[model samples]
Target chain A: MIEAAKTIPVVRGAFREYYFKQARAVEEPGKIEQREFGYAQFGQAGMTRHLSFNSIKELHAMLVKEVPSDVYCSNAYYKFPTQPMQEKQWLGADLIFDIDGKDLDLPCVPSHTYPVCTNCGHALPPSDEKKEYSCPSCNGKKAERVSIPCSKCIEGSKKEVRRLIEFLTTDLGMQRDNIYVYFSGNNGFHIHIGDSEYVPLDPQARSDIVGYLSGTGLLAESVGVRKGREGNMSFIKFPRGGIAYGWRGRIADKLKIDGSSIIKLKHIVDQKGGYAGFKSELDKMTREMGVRIDPQVTTDVHRIFRMPGTLNSKSGLAKTRCADLESFNPFNDACLLGGNKVNVRVKTHVKLKLKGEAFNISKESAELPAFAAVYLICKGLAEAM
Target chain B: MPVQLMTSNLSSIRMGTGDLAKYPFLNEAGEYLRESGFGWEELDRPDMKDIIDRAAERIEVGVGGNIYDKLEKYEIEILTFIVSLIMVKSIGMEPVLKKYALSEARRAEEFLTQDLKQQSEMQKHSLFAKIFEDLFKLKIEVAEDGRLFKVRVADYLARSSHFHEQEWKLINRLVQGGHVYLDADETVRLVRNELSVLIYEKVKAMTLPTLPQAIKVKAEELRAKLAPRYEYRTSAVTEYPPCVKHAIEVMSKGENLPHSARVMLATYMLAVGKPVDEIVMMFQNAPDFNEKITRYQVEHLAGMKGSRTKYSVPSCEKLRNENLCFATEECNGIINPVQFGRKRK
Candidate 1:
């Protein structure tokens, strides 16, 4: 049973050193110990909840102790009367934003999705996940299987993050002093807005902010864009008011329709007219422009998030902060361990790019550097020898 | 709406400051700005960062009213709401803000009804902004007698379409004499979604002032004082279920706990073997309490004197639906207070 454990790649000495570094925890543990924390170790049972830390030392001690597969901490700071959380008072919580590439509706990247055999469970290479999305092992017995992401897919996610940051600063009055952005170590990014001004906002208040971003329940007619009251209004002329500076104005300008001409221009707005259906057109437009957000993560004050500076098990990448968001590259930046090599027994064919180098491996044993091999091993493409 | 003329000796109208007097936040620092060629004329200049820094430093020490004193009532409202947000969130000013907000909500109701001539969109938003500004930031209590009372202000505010549907219910209470006190976390709770949220934050940030420690402390102390005061008999309270404890606490504060809260309280007391007279006696703090009517109601619920069909204590579902459930961890899987106490055993 011990010998039958899954195979993974690691450089000659890097995997052990990475394990040691994590065990020792070179940096101060529980950097966000002031915030509430919960964890889930690799268990045969399932993910656990309500695991908290008293201080950074305790959290670091847990890291060395449990070596959890996933670690999470709440965005909130609470004064717990007891560990039971019954008598605890909600002091405040940080505003958080999460944009995921896996959740994005973008077309298939070159190496993002993977096709797996429904019968034999064999997954094809990411390159052939689309178009020829048939299992090579089972000989065309399965459909395409969606995987996490490729580097280019994450780049698309990064662009969304930049756009969101800009919207938050200009429209929501978020100060740069309080905003902290981190890669989720998988296929997305997590942004924490620790602005003092926002801590007091409630779930409903946060919901309103999220609504604006997602355009879930946006009220374009209620905005000052229309000249008169609803049912009796005139179109807003170009170079709109301060209120229409965001998408409400942009969408209107793009469609070249004003309130007065809205019904007359129904052909452009809603070609598939089904009596009183222009509103559907508006919904489509908002959906196109709106940024998809994980609402539960942001509004929940007690929500625990992935601990930064730890390993993201899915990708074998460190969840580190981006010093410069624009120049940040997670594939390279997430590699925290030093240059060390480990021999890996190849169990399956896999192609991966890491630290500015690309490698293609066949179904044969091979030795590679630490970062690249670790990526394959973590991805379960090889076994460490 | 009138173009009121500025005739004060310190009237810096011609200083090209663009309606600074109307705002009412002008002071020595403002005068210094005027003297140093740094009014609205120098507002958006890239070189004014140093001047802004000096101004910020002076304000940090708390001596200048230049920026705060001359703000128009409306401008002050937006600024106050922003500052009040900090106080409630960081400093625990829920009670203080609730008190401030209750009075302000009353004032806002009155303010909203007043037919001011030529109310522009800006003026309307300003009116709302000022109400909220005062609601969250200020700590004003002119008298103990007038500090709190009962009113159906939630119902009143709900009648008007101007306010958020959730607000009046959360904040206002039915005070006696057909008045209500707007005192709840709703002001602090509702600000993030309020109309001012739509305002350009960069523009709104200019009006915000750093809240001093004194204000926060005062709010915290008042909030501590206002913690749900319950005059329950100590011996009786120990055996009361979480729902009963919660209902009595709200009632003791002269609040009209929901109709279901009252029903649940009565039923629980009846089940606990408390006499109808004592149960009716418990309701005296409610502003709507009337002896004969309360006794009749309690007796009807007891099933001893009225309809003869004894009403069972509401299940957790009913209590939760009435928004009166305050279940502790031990209360889990227990439906009635009698069961809750037995489970503890």
Candidate 2:
């Protein structure tokens, strides 16, 4: 009976280890205990009495001649093919050059201010007011004047800036603090990444990070890891072996034919590289021979992420920032890339304390916090720190 | 002889010559009779009788023949015709007749008189002809009332008993008074109240007997038959002990029994020292036992603690065996300490 057992090509060792751990945890009184080596040892114990025959031919003969009560069992694994690679850069790059006026000196005063209205058109007094500057002429009944460039000057530049920001932060996984946004002096904005640590990742790693940002990576692997069943969930390990083993166990249970009988039939093969490659071969064999192997196999390999605080881990960072690239425009002098048009007509008042002296910075300051603020904002990093 | 013939012709001519010439007195008699109400009883009055008699006498004198005999023999008919003609004329038949009347006064007069008599006879015949007509109308009204009554009764009875047309008709007849008889609305109210009472009584009387009445009765007889040698246990040992016989009866009767009854029986049997294997075997032999036992096991294991569900029974059993009782683990975990204290005591 042991000699009659069939050999199936699958990553049986890896899956057995995983399933054994799960089965042990659930073993308790008044519950069905998981069988240990039950699939391999069932034939030797003569428990096969419940089963009518050792082979498909014998089973078929029993079914024809006898009461048709014999149960046949067999197991197979599940596997599917991995997608073929197509060469394309997962990372994107965008370069913006200043074409307006002569470049300013290093550490130049970042003062570029325009006074219009924080709300609607009504010239405000030079006094440094609160964050919300209301129109004094209308007594807050009408809108205050906003300081934005005329619409004709900056139309499409802000969108380009926004796209660049999304590609860097959400796609490239670069921290917003690592990004530097600056005005091009004439039209558009330049997004500079001085950090070099993020540049040399492999395509797979880049794709994985992209997948994490888009929230569409390996869900099964993460769940398996959280479940704490070894080999069930792993970022680096192949899952096809375990999936195939589970399929084999299910098929054996369903068919009621022992694995030995399958081995005697000489239909099983020990395919290398786990059960991942066995799925298509098994399907072809089943289709041509009009007989299906009990267990199916899955071959697809996927990359999983170990992001902090996700998948049973504690202390996951919960928040990130996004740059408002819709405000970036390039056609107008006040416009930056990604449709960010400087509000030339709107005035933002800031009080800068420099050298123990408070400078009431109004719309007259040439250096506003637009570049610094935008860089920090786009990378989903903290601002003003 | 020729002279006599000429005189007769002249007399006839004088009698029928003009409106005033032929029976001129008829206009006056007609005017007198027209003032009287035309009811049949009015014809018997002395004044009408006298005018009619005088009219006959004048006709007799004018015609120089037995005109009075003719009038007397057919006076009722003639008078009725004349009254009817006058009534018809008053109601606007005279203008129509006048327009069609012949220019010959004697012939026109004779024709009008004969036509009036015929019209009067036709009216009498018509009254007798349609005597059964009103009977059909009355029957139709009664039938319509019966239909409405039936609908009301049917609606009322349907609320409690199965709706049957014959039963509704019977009830309708049994009840008296139009409001009660055809009182479909009131009947519905009564039916609902009666059904409510019936249902309440049935539910209130429901109980879980340890031994079913049928089995107890049979057991007594069997014990009596064996009384000389052995005695049988007639009472149940467990509170709300399950009665398998009674359960079968309930199920057969098509009534949904409370699930507690089955659980009570199973638990009681188990408490009384029935082995699990024996219980399983017993269930296997029982009708529809597989379904019942499977449901019982699943529910007993899965149901909330203290719930009347089958799952609750197992939890209770577990506690009973351990002699450690607790409402639930979530109740501050007090049961563990209580059990420990009990053990210490």
Candidate 2 residue spans exceeding 4 A from truth? A1-136, A139-349, A352-358, A361-385, B1-345
Q: What is the DockQ of each candidate?
A: 0.02, 0.00
In candidate 2 the C-alpha lDDT for residue B162 amounts to: 28
For candidate 1 chain A, which ten residues in a row score worst on lDDT? Answer: A1-10
Give a tens-digit lDDT track for model 1, residues A226-261: 333544234433221222345544465767655455
DockQ of 1: 0.02
Q: Residue by residue across A228-279, what tens digits does model 2's lDDT show?
A: 2443221222222222222222233433434344332122223222232233
Considering summed lDDT, which 10 consecutive residues are worst modelled in model 1 chain B?
A: B58-67
Residue lDDT tens for model 2, B1-345: 011112222222211112222222233233333444444455445566554444333322322322222233233434633432232222222222232121112322343333323424554222211211221111101223332222222222223232222122221122211111323232223333332233223323435235323323333443343334323334333322124445445655655544454454355445454555554444443434575554456345334233444322323222322222223323222222212212222
How many angstroms is residue B161 displaced in model 1 relative to the true structure, after the best TM-score fit? Answer: 15
The best candidate by lDDT is 1
- Which tens-of-lDDT digit does each residue in B1-345 have in candidate 1? 222224353233232223332321223223433354533433235563433333222222221112222233433332343333333344333333333334333333332333121134434433333433343332212112332212222223223213333223221122222233332223222332232232222223344344354444443653454444322333333577788888889999998787778988899888878888899999999877899999999998877675477888876633542346776767855755657756534
Candidate 1 docks at the CAPRI level of: incorrect
